[model samples]
Target chain A: MTSISIIGTGKMGSAIAEVAARAGADIQIIRRRAGAGSSLERGDAEYGLVGDQLTGELVVLAVPYEAYPSVLGHYRDRLDGKIVIDISNPIDFTTYDELLVPADSSTAVELSQALPAGARVVKAFNVNLGDTLSTGTNGTTTTTVLFAGDDPAAKIAVADLIEAAGLRAVDAGPLSRARELEAMGFLQIVLAAIGKTRYESGFALLQ
Target chain B: MTSISIIGTGKMGSAIAEVAARAGADIQIIRRRAGAGSSLERGDAEYGLVGDQLTGELVVLAVPYEAYPSVLGHYRDRLDGKIVIDISNPIDFTTYDELLVPADSSTAVELSQALPAGARVVKAFNVNLGDTLSTGTNGTTTTTVLFAGDDPAAKIAVADLIEAAGLRAVDAGPLSRARELEAMGFLQIVLAAIGKTRYESGFALLQ
Candidate 1:
């Protein structure tokens, strides 16, 4: 059984949690800021505050790109040795006109640099919209999660988590390839914003 | 009936020619340098050398980004009042590490500026691999062509050609959206180069 710790309570985080639940993994939700007092029992998933010690071998950073510095700072040395899943599309949200990361790099690469040396960064879920993941399908096409990482073992583990949820998982080369994935995400966002496409529709890897 | 004159008879040009054939459109294949004397006939499609006068209402630039200068110069005024379809990826093939175009503009935008004032430039087919377009299928999923352009009539003309070929055509907003589409093409190409994906597989937009 896999143990997963996800930080963030937004739509993306909630969407990923559904996958962990379906996998029967031990789910831990670490909020960036504790929500108002409705913290009663919500299924078998555990809840923790931002600075709380991470309890899962796999830590998913489901928050926005803007929250990375603060969240990564909170974890600091604690993230070492844990597989960190960075699912962020580091676009400047105010205008959404451009990506905030270096033109040559991606949010996943940036997260890898900021994390503790031993932490492995697996890039996934950034290419997907929350509604598609939650619905588990883009109409007839099943949601496929494209993940990339430098560590083979870490990639296998992340793929297992995603596959256990009955969704497809594609290996999109190495972590550096996240640059392309972020661009795909950016395109999806802008298309939806301009009403060219829908949040329910996204870039699907089809064989 | 719609008529399409394609500049460049490489794999990309051949693929678009197939689309026009299916659309029942009159097709013209223009070779950069006249091919060896093997030119007998290719169905109803006509063949021409570079400097030959273009006869179709729609001129498809199926050549690579590298040949743009010479090809464009050859057909400079000939492209006037034509719907010019640019399907080039603008990738630096020497090292597939980067897209040759600027951060803010796409090959379509550049072609628009370079062509005569009445020419309409539409960006399409660059996101697809030659294999996928040629085969008309990526295993189970059918090919979906995403096109962007400033001209509504041009986009519709290109979409009709694609749909007539039994593939889906998606309108990806205005010409500026070509930047995102080019990024999508870059990712697909690099992924294929690294063995992460296949030339027979590509980015499919699911409902």
Candidate 2:
């Protein structure tokens, strides 16, 4: 069984936890500083504090893009030899007019650069809404998770996790392709925020 | 019956012609110069020369973004009282690294400003691949055409045209929202180019 550690207890974090638990992975919910030890109401997953040793090989940073710096600072070299998933769409929330990251790079790429060399960064779940991820469906269509990274093994692991949860997973090429995924995610969020589309569903990649 | 004059016989133009013809719209195919006047081999669209007057009220600029200047200059003041559909994704095709227009504006907005005040500019079809539009399906799912414009009447006309062709048309908010649609379209094209996804299939907006 693949062990997973998801940081942040926001909507995205909770949604991913629901799916990961459904996939029967050993789940660890890390909420920045920690909360009620193990809340069975959310999921039957282990809850950890900031200072706790990162146990799961697959660690997901489900926090907002702004939290990466602090999270990485605390974890630092501890993230070595782990599969770090970056699911943040680094868009400006204040004006919703621009993205915070460099035009050429994505949050995932930036996260990878900050993490230890041994940490494999995979870009996934950034393109999905929290509601869609939790429901595992975009209306009648099964939620399709698009992921990208340089490591084949890391991509396979994340794909397996998503697929095991009764969702669809797609490999969107190298980590550089995260730029396109970020664009798609940003567009979806903007549409939802403006009431042009629904947050419960998003742009589905139908086969 | 609505008449559509498509400028450029490229894949996108031809694909749109197929749908518009099926929709029972009178089609007028206008190449850069002239064609074998009304070739029935390529749908029943009437072929016309550059000097010919646009008979269709719905003028589709199916040409590449680069040709917009010349096309607009040629028919500058002539597009009055017409509904012009701008389907060009203004991306730098040479490297696919950047979009050609300003970050705050879209090609449709630019076209709207360049044309006569009476002419209504609608942004549509830039989000779809020619093959998907031609087949009216993105694999098992029907192709959903996303359109945006300030004029509700123009949107209704385009929506009616799309629905008549057995495809889905979605209103993606005001003309300013074309930025998001362009981003989506650009992502799809880049994915196809990198073999991450198929050209015949695209991001389906499944309800």
TM-score of each model, paired residue for residue: 0.86, 0.82
A76-151 per-residue lDDT for model 1 (tens digits): 6899999999999888889767889887788899889987789999999988988878778865677889888999
List the global CA lDDT of all models: 0.83, 0.84
Q: Which runs of model 2 end up more than 4 angstroms from their true locations?
A: A33-43, A91-104, A113-119, A193-200, B36-44, B80-82, B90-106, B109-120, B150-153, B193-198
Q: What are the per-residue Cα lDDT tens digits for candidate 2 across B64-108?
A: 899999998788788888999999888898977567887667798
Backbone steric clashes in candidate 2, count = 0
Instruction: In model 1, state the lDDT of residue A204.
Output: 75
What clash pairs does model 2 have? none
TM-score between candidate 2 and the true structure? 0.82
Model 1 misplaced stretches (Cα beyond 4 Å): A36-41, A92-97, A135-142, A192-201, B36-41, B92-96, B103-105, B113-118, B131-142, B164-166, B192-198
